[model samples]
Target: MGQRLGVDVIYTGPSTADASEQVRILEDMISRGVSAIAVAPNDAAAVTPVLIKARNAGIAVLDWDTPADESVVDYSVQQVDSTVYARHMYDLLVQNMGESGDYAVVTGGLSAENLNIWIDEGLEYAKVKYPGLTLVTQRIPSDEKQQLAYQKTLDLLKAYPNLKGILGYSTPAPIGVAQAVQEKGLQSRIAVVGVALPTDSGPYLEDGSLDVATLWDPGKLGALTVYVASELLNGRAIADGQDVPGVGRITVRGKVIVMGPPSDFTKENYKDYTF
Candidate 1:
C-alpha cells in the first residue's frame, strides 16, 4: 500500500516485550526524519513521550492494533469495538461450557492496553450476562509466547481440575491452552477460545481442542494504516463512515478509526483462511 501511495515505509519491532526498545526505535525514526510512522505500541505509557516527539518533529503518527496515549497520536485504528468483541468471545465460551462453571483468562501481557481492556470487559460481561460462570483467576500474563502459555495452562489445569473453559486474549494463548488440554485428553471437558489466525489454530479446531478463534484481516490492517497515513500526509480529511481501501467503511469516533466487524473461525471454517 505504501508503495502504491509512493511513500517510503520502514517497519521495525522490538525483539521482546521491551518498552525501552520501542522507545529507542521511535527515537531513531525521529532522527531519520521519516514523514510518517504507524505503530502498535507494546506499552502505551512508555511509548507516549517518544510518539509526542515524533509528532513534534513534523511526522504523522498513526497508532494501529494497540493504541498509544491518545494525546500524542493523530488517529488510532482498531479491529472493532473492544467491549463488544470481548462480550462476543465470552458468550462463545459460556455456550461451549454450558454456562455454569469456572473459567480463566490468559492474556498477551498485563501492559498491553487492548488485551487488558478486552479481558476486563469480558469479565464485566460475564458478571452481568452469564452469572452462573465463575472466573477462576485474575488476568494472567502469557508474554505473548505459545510455549509459556502452554506451561501456564498446564499449571492451571493441575491447580483447577474442574476448570470448564479458558479464554485467551492473545493470539497464541488459545492455541497453547488447546495443546495443554489435548495432551491431557480433556478436549471434551475444557473449551478454549481466543483471537488467532486460522492457519495457526486449524489443527486444534479440527481435533475439537479449540472451540473458536476470532480476528480481523491483519493484512487489511497494515494496508489501512498505510492508506490512512497517506491520506493524512496529502491533507485529506477522514470523516465518519469513510471507505478505507481494504478495510471497508470505517467509523471515526474522537481520534479513533474503527475497522469493521471481526470474523470467527470454527472447526468447519478454519480451513478456509490462511491468516
Candidate 2:
C-alpha cells in the first residue's frame, strides 16, 4: 500500500521491554532516509521522543491505531474516535440485550489508553442510557494468547451468574468469549459484541453465539496514511475536509481524523465483506 501511494514506509516494529532499543531502531529508520513513517506505537508516550527526532530531521510522521505524542506527529489516523466507537458498542449491546442486563467489558489492557478510553465512553453511555443495566466486571485478559480470553470468559461467567451481555475491545477476546459462551451453553442467555475480523468470528455469528463485530478495512487506513504522507512530503497542505483519492473524504477535528464508519459485521452482512 505504501509503495502504491508513492511513498516508502519502514516499520519501527513492536515495542520491546527495553526502551533504548526501541529508540535506536526508530532512529535507524530515519537515518536510512525513510521520508515519512507510520506507526502504531506500543507505548504511546515512550515513542514520542523518537518521533520528535524524526520531525527535527524533516520527516513526516503519522500515527495510526495507537496514538503518539500529538506535537511530534503531523497527523493521526484511527479506525474511529475512542468515544464514538464506545457509544456504538454500547448501542449494539443495548439493542441485543433489550436495554437492561448485567454486562461485562473485555478490554485489551487496563493501561492501554485507547482501550481505556473506549471503555470509559461505554461506561458513561450505559450509565446515562441504560440505568437499569449493571456492569458486574470489566476483564482485561492476557491478550497474547487466545486461551487467556477463553479462560477469562469462563471466570466472568462464574463470577456473574446473571451476566447477560459482554462488550469486548480486544481482537481475540470476542472470539474466545463466544467460544466460552457456546461451551457453557450460555449463548441464548448472554450476547457478545466487539471489534473483530469477519473470518475470525464468522462461525460464532453464523451460529448465533456472538451478536456482532465492529470492523473497518484496516488496509485502507494503512493505504491512506501513505497517501497522506506523500502529500505532506510534496509540501501540499491537507485541509480539514479535503478528499484523498483512496481514503474517501476526510474531516479533521482537532488532532484526530475520522477515517470511516465502524463496519458492523454480522450474519446479515458478514458474507459481503472480504476483510
TM-score, per-candidate, Cα-based: 0.98, 0.91
lDDT of 2 at 230: 81
The runs of at least 3 residues in candidate 2 whose Cα sits more than 4 Å from the true structure, single-residue gaps closed, are 15-25
TM-score of 2: 0.91
Best by TM-score: 1
Provide the clash count, candidate 2.
0
Whole-model Cα lDDT of every candidate shown, in order = 0.88, 0.79
**Candidate 1, 144-197: lDDT as tens digits:** 888888999999999998999999877888888888988998999899998899
Best by lDDT: 1
Give the Å error, residue 178, model 2. Answer: 1.2
The Cα error of candidate 2 at residue 122, in Å, is: 1.6
Q: What is the C-alpha RMSD of each candidate to the true structure, in Å?
A: 1.0, 2.3
In model 2, where is the ten-residue run with the lowest total lDDT? 11-20
